[model samples]
Target: MTSAHPAPSNTVNAPGTLAAANEEFWSNSAETIFNEPWVLDFQAKMRAFLEKNIDWLGIVNDRTSATEGAEKKMLDYACGDGFLTRVYHPFFTKCIGIDIAAGMVKKYNEAAIELGLASEKMYAVKGDFSASVLELPKAEDVASTDLSRDEFFNFDFVGVALALHHMEDPETAIVKMVERLKSGGVFLAIDLLNSEGVSESKDEEGNGGNHHHHHQGGHSHGHGHGHSHGTTATGRSGPAGHTISHDHPAFSIELVKDMFDRAGLTDVDIIYSDWKLELPFVTDPGAKLLVARGRKQ
Candidate 1:
């Protein structure tokens, strides 16, 4: 029962200053985390996780570019470091990643360039995809006809992975993401859940910022576990290794269903991975993770 994401003693910061504050934290540490060796492993885990959990290739590969015929487009919202974006790049003809953290987006673009993704096919932009607060293409711009024509809303597929737990309002975020999709577009989400099945308590995350997702890795805001679930916890574990805990109440599977239903997504389905994941970076035993998918009507 090792603890996951033990913030390196020298650099743990405060809990999210606010729902939006997590972006600031990630902006400051974006480069450092992008350079971390564990990030590479994390990327691999992301790819494997998606492969094991969904028919990701089939989903992204389903669409074809109107112009190129064989190409498809995707958006990776809240795409920290574009780790997941890079993973899915090979499948889409064009993949655009957006992040609240400008530095993270910059690093994402740099990584894409380094991979020689042909600028037009893969790129990252700095923006808050969670809302339409920012205006694009000023009044004088030729392409600025209707705000509806904004590039932000154009995507064949959208993905939000390991990020919903950090949101100020996961439900609104889900609704807005689905709104960005064209009719029949797909939305995929993967996030951590509060498996304790216990009602949330103020003290659940504990103090001194020992909560999950407020990781020691300098990312500062996430849902990775930092505590123990004990013998009362029902899940089985693999070889003894480090475990991850949650700082905020884990979103229950039911909550996820409700959000999807409220968003009017059809064909919604969710599943919990049967086995526990052991990461090279975090030590604690892990929790059951949920994978969900739906299509916009």
Candidate 2:
């Protein structure tokens, strides 16, 4: 039952280790970026959309909630500081949050424990999404790394929020993600849209690159151009000469649709487009937030 796609040949500029990037972002200005009241509100709305409309818990029951004794299992891929993880705990019977950053995972675990969600029913783990496969624990099994497609035929759902856009090869990432799902399982994704035709390019330092904005449609709606400056959640400048623009990777949207098709998923639905206003301090003006849902065939 395990399915894998050929490894992607395209090499996007490595953004360094995920942990380093997050640590830099957090230590330097993460509080300013993530602690804003408006940012919190936006996150709450997104979580609500996934929980209420997506029927996330019900989907975990193999998309057959009417069955009386179906056990539910779910994974929150690239789950940041477990912001969404906290919101999802009450809905699903068994939930696991995985993140690439060890620091992020540690913080999430602390939060979960504080919230009394560190019990056996719920947990968080440090995992790499770019890796080929994830070794997850089965419901009844104690501790085993012998996880294969044969042992667990399906996952009720897999969710990636704001995390996919960071990957260099999101298409390959999507293919691998879908292969982990069972028939009728759901994949929910929320990511930034590249409305401004921006591309990633490295500067002289060879540090992680930054996005340069290119005007596409007449959709300009945020701050003016040229080394855009804005306050962070903790009221700090993000990066030198970094503007808040909505320039996502070129293939972001198209790649999602193509992966859905290639994975043999159906009933592909755009649950929420333009869910909330993109943080003005992040990227280009009028940046869009897209939420899509697809069911594996």
Best lDDT among the predictions, by candidate number? 1
Runs off by more than 4 Å, candidate 2: 1-34, 55-69, 131-153, 196-252, 274-278, 282-285
Report the Cα lDDT for residue 169, model 1: 58
Candidate 2 residues 1-297, lDDT tens each?
A: 000001121233334343334434433542344566766777766666556654522354443542445656566766656665566555455666665555455565666677776456566665444534443645563322233434223566777776654454455567766777767777777664444212221121143222222212222222232211221111113341121111222223344555556556666654323243545344344344546677777
- Candidate RMSDs in Å, in order, are 11.1, 12.2
What does candidate 1 score on TM?
Answer: 0.67
What's each prediction's TM-score? 0.67, 0.62
Highest TM-score model number: 1
User: Per-residue lDDT for 170-213 in model 1, tens only?
Assistant: 67778878888878888877765554422222234354221222
lDDT (Cα) of model 2: 0.48
